[model samples]
Target: MAESHIDLGVVTAPSGVLVLGMASWIDHWPQLGGTLSERARASASIGGGHVHDWMCEMVAVRAAGDRPLTVRAGTAKSPLDGGPTIATLEIDLGIPWVRTAGNEPIILGDLPVDRCGMVLGDALALDSWTGDGHPSTDGLADVTYWGAHAEAAHRQFGGELIPGRGNQVRGWLDLPLDDAKSLGDALGDWTGDEQGRGVMVAVDEHNDFHSFNRASRTHPLLIGAIEVADCPVLGINWDSGDHSMRHRGERPFGQVYPVTLQPDRTGRTTMRWTIPPYAPGHDGPE
Candidate 1:
């Protein structure tokens, strides 16, 4: 018997999906030089308007339903039909491939789906823009839907899954920081720390050939750690340090092209996910 290399399934995009994770979150951390509120007051500001206006504009732009609401899903099979590791999500938001399950199951989905489900049934696309937001580099759907779903669950299960309606219960409706941190903290098991120390290091792809696939852009990419306690997330950016996922912080590992996400405040939200481990020296997974 040989290990199964691929598992195929249908994960719904819900026809109104926008960005995944905090992919479109604009950084407003008060410490990284200053918060978005301060940037508006800074003399260096070129347009002579409060930076928040741009953020508001961006948020509005993303919410206008202008992008696709499709999510790509597939599975990772083990050698042979060894079943699956049934990885439970301690903190999984926009997983690339997953299914809902029943009874006692190892994998999230009950049985392996051989075909698409009701979620995949294409609804008449009402518009070109599904909602305001951007997609993750890895292309996951906005998982902030968790909040809406959580609310519905609370009405039924009442204190079974989570205590309350995510950030709303966490008091993060209109935060001052980038929406990414809030989206992550919405998991309720994590805390966010902003960093002013940034870096950009080019790694040798060694003819990986996949290098050409990277989306090219001109924003200063920063490399820093978002410590979800022991799980430190390393990220890259190419947008003007304005959004979270777009943070072009360069990484050294060409091998680990890791990116996970969750929905942010805007419609084009981020669906948070996990990052692969990086080699560390002194500062853990920096």
Candidate 2:
């Protein structure tokens, strides 16, 4: 008797990989095995060349023979631009998993697998991520590594980034193009996944925050509103100086800053801050 393989389903995207949270439950799921796995081709807009494709396999050992297989694939329409492909698979496991794969100009979702790859080949082409130690196997540091590259790409192209609330309070903030780069740099390299990178870009870029909660991973703080003096306010927001979320004390609540771009010590661009006296624990001018 020959081994039987099921046509689980296929997901198509521009460039990013869509991992459907299989590793979490599949238990040592095959990086290249699985009855659900198969070969897939990406539909790029251009022609005159061979169509690129990738392996979409599910390890045979991990296949759940007792349960029925269900696969759903489709494109998530965006309010602004085209979105990435989303495919959900339910093969006995109760957990909900969706997969997507594609390149650039395609918006990524908040799935762990999606975040694992970050925006490596798409927006930011970092050689390091392509080499080895993928985030899925290497762990958190790898996630941060990919995140830094993705954030760098977003920095080059101005935008907003709103992450899922995930136990933290949520809100929104609008940033000016000029201020976006400076503030991103001053905040240091971003340290989240593709979802985090999505949250970092503003609405103008592609509104990647769609469906995901509008919040911050560290501490949820919104600027609410602000009024600056003679200096035109380039941007406004609750500057939570500490993104590490290490501070246990009552955070500097309502600490608003008038955003502006300025040259850092290295003569490179950075965000310059203008603190107000009324701000919590604000010590007057130096």
Kindly list the per-residue Cα lDDT of model 2 for residues 19-42, writing each as its tens digit: 122111222223334211221112
- Where model 2 places Cα greater than 4 Å from the true spot, the runs are 1-163, 167-174, 186-286
Per-residue error at 64 for model 2, in Å?
27
Task: Summarize candidate 1's per-residue lDDT along 121-235 as a digit string, tens digits.
Answer: 1111111111122223222211122343445433432332212222433222222233434444444432122432212111212110111112211111221222211222222
How close is every model to the real structure, measured as TM-score? Answer: 0.18, 0.18
- Runs of candidate 1 with Cα error greater than 4 angstroms are 1-68, 77-286
TM-score of 2: 0.18
Q: How well does candidate 1 match the true structure in TM-score terms?
A: 0.18
